[model samples]
Target: MAFTGRDKTWLRGPRAVGLLAAGAAVVLGLATGGTVTQAAPAKPKPTHTQIQLLSINDFHGNLAPNPATSSSGNVNGTPAGGAEYLATQLEMLRASAKAQGQETATVAAGDLIGASPLLSAAFHDEPTIEAMNEMGLDATSVGNHEFDEGWHELLRMQKGGCLNDGDGQNNQNSCPDPKNEFKGADFEYLSANVFYENTKKTLFRPYTVKKFKDGQKVAFIGMTLENTPNIVTKSGIAGLTFTDEVATANALVPELRKQGIESIVVLLHEGGFPSDPKAYNSCPGISGPVTEIAKNLDPAIDAVLTGHTHAAYNCSINDPANKPRLVTSASSFGKIVTEVRLSIDNATHDVDRLNTLANNKIVTQDVPKDPALTKLITKYQTLVAPIESKVIGHITTPTVVRTNDDSLESPLGNLIADAQLADTSAVTNGKTPVVAFMNPGGIRGDLASNGGAVTFGQAFTVQPFNNYLVSMDMTGTQIKALLEQQFSGLNGPEAPKFKVLQVAGITYTWNPAAAAGSKVVPGSIKIAGQPLVDSTTYRIVTNNFLSDGGDGFPAFTTATDKFFGGLDIDGFANYLTAHDPYTPVATDRISIGS
Candidate 1:
């Protein structure tokens, strides 16, 4: 459940690490000793010193000041997610660890790349790679978007060390050769589960053994969702196969043991819990697959660091009633960093205890930007300024994108589906530019088209996740079956959250009382103003998220000839810019006639 971009500022920041200790400082009775001296209370017993695991997730290439809504009603103004603020935060956390006689590590779960704005995506993740290096990310998992440019491009980005100027400090790696250019990453990407099916080769080192100042070794295993094939373009992962996550972790545990490392932590690329903007303590209890995965995962592994849902949580999940296996996720877009402090048992070589601490600090502009990295960002920013600032088009009216809103369809959703159908049909070299479908979950935000002009950010508010346009061939019957899956609620009782689908090239009315496949109201199905041929195979364009079965659309999973390239947002923007000053007609793409 990638968080759709929005201005939900009312939700309070999730519970941060220090808040809990502040309240419990006295209530837990740490100040009182067994024998309290009458004069000025005797000093309390010392607490166990702990190592800090610092982490941030979904830092989507925000190298400059950006607008984000705070959990409070504050608009948060233009003040979040520059690498400089992150650096300041990390530095402060490190200083605290130094005072505590413990070690601190900075890390991220995933979304290190892809869906980035023009600044980073212009060079295909180079800017992000540079920023992450400056922020000192120790290790990261292979996020689904990491495969956006394909695996080969990722390899180049990872190996192509930091960019360098003539200072001789060599802040970045200079590409050795044009063809063999390699820019090495400050950290490694761990994908312990992704493997090549034909060659049986593991994609990357499954886990990294990071050492602390005190020589304590902790193994970090990184695994993205096993459903990567469904979310990413087929061409990007043609031969590679994604195995089951739990199965992969179970197999890797023994390997870590062989390496004399048993204090294992999983930096998994998955997240859960819908955060309430109003309450800091009321984190949406873990209800997604991630919580289940955390519970069923090999308990030998100590902590699970997760991302992708873009929500926030700070409590223990799935160990016992009160004692919990620590699981936490910082909200997306540099909103927060989760700090997990683990106390390792020296003799047993295991994580003796775990505590989750969250920091909901805004990545503000108050911090001075890193000179070297800022200069680098300025260089790229200059390069991309023209295209990024270009005025694409105008919207007739504001389009909303609340999943909880059960309207007929969203204006943004219609625009995106229209582009998918049009662009994919032109590329297929086909005569009948037939059907297009856009998953509702992919339309992230609403565009306020009135009283103001639309910019890149305004347009991106509608479609931001960077999903690629995927075209597949499916029989009319199969398409109907796919629609049935959306209505069945097989995903969950709230499966309705995933039920919205925008369609083009056809119109039909649905009835809740009718049988699943036959729910289409008779005489209501229309294709090109005629009747849909049930046996005819139709060419359909949709996002890769659904083509591979994201959001439980199994019907497209079996469809063939999946074509992918430009992102869904980009395609929509291209469509808008090309056909601007647009009308706001509903277009009657799909109708639910009672």
Candidate 2:
């Protein structure tokens, strides 16, 4: 549904912008039933309109409170998360703004639901979306994680409905109680850069103009990182085209201007990491894809709210015009909410960029909880408690760490890789897999065995993608090519270094400073204590994500004789159960240039 001329607030910029209209495109349209209500006319434009914009990102549905590590935040060492706590903080912030006679609206940079814990993933992320609806999210950009279950499922997430992808109901959301229907999101989802392959149209609304009461409005252009194709599953975005973020946002500036809109905010689902991870609101030595992107954005964009990197930073990045602009990210999970008070100059219909104040407010448990959110979380917790608490394994040690050494290998990754290798070996039927690799991003969290008990929920949280295992035959030469391909990064513009994969049943040395194709030292690779020969065929096993060429590893697609194994999480649990009182193996299979 294209935005129709219905009320004063229905200011759709152009017919070609392809903004999701409120009616026909029900799946991706706004939840006001395709219509926006009108606000009374203003007597006169004030000199300034101070509006509060509350933002969050990478909230992967941590309904329960999490430690500092899972959220990548610890302001002087404090825990965060718990939908109730997050909601209470936002509510309090918004109330304070209203008290000061300021309009308030909350938005997010995306990742509101993918890569979730067992509590949310078990119900197909319905609980997360519901929590968002209750928390009063106004709009957001679609992050890469949103495509984890594929595009159609994303549409279902926006337009409320139960998933029916059967087979144990993982993808299927057959609500046991019909009254608990998924009512969809009341907020809007903006994706200015995501387009269709054949039709060349946007997958969702490119931009949405949120009109407030005093003739003041702000246009939000939401877009994910253009490189989403490289990180996400090939099948999830099979026919979608993710354009360059800068180009896409720049082209839309003129369209937004035509609608008499001046104040602009980019709900960008891409961000950077600050040098100090604990400094939730300060940008010191910020570096990543977003820094470069923010510097090139059009000056028309006043503020850029970002995410995806999962790190928090409040930066005044210089735009192409060499003008300082607001760029912010509120860490990950429900830990922090970035508060930006934009003072718009009504006289000039422009943003007083210098006066904009933004900071990340920690969602500390010290505050009271939102009853609504507490109820919502409790309902789901009760439904999932049995499955979540069931003991799946045991561990001798109570502590596990995922922080990588110089080799980019960690105990958590090693455990996952070895588990994957072991699962394939158990079901090989004489075929036999010699090596297995696990992508770093797939290892969501460290499997801590606190209290020496491993719950099903903890295991599921470690491998939440529900990806299956795939065994394929690749010659030793192809195997080397696979390892070398990790350095290729992808077939596109240059990007940050690829994350090294965790390996089991293999050991090799590589020089990071060496030339791309020759990074691996010669005669250094060994599989099961046997030298790798270029001509010998070797069976390899990896998660389905890699076999489909995800995470920039195209070499995985070159393998032949593919056989689908069991689910990755299942295999991991089986391995843990098999090795009860399991102890994390030493991380020595990887070696760097040092």
TM-scores for every candidate against the unseen true structure: 0.79, 0.88
**Error in Å for residue 454 of model 1:** 4.2
lDDT of each: 0.61, 0.76
**Model 2, span 404-473: residue lDDT tens:** 8888889989888889999953355578888998998898877866499998888887889988889988
Candidate 2, lDDT over the whole model: 0.76
Candidate 1: regions farther than 4 A off: 1-49, 69-80, 161-184, 198-200, 274-284, 320-323, 354-373, 398-408, 422-430, 447-473, 488-496, 512-523, 537-539, 543-551, 557-571, 592-594
Tens digit of per-residue lDDT, candidate 1, span 128-159:
78777777677787788888767876776667
TM match of model 1 to true structure: 0.79
Count of clashes, each model = 17, 5
Report residue 4 deviation for candidate 2 (angstroms). Answer: 14
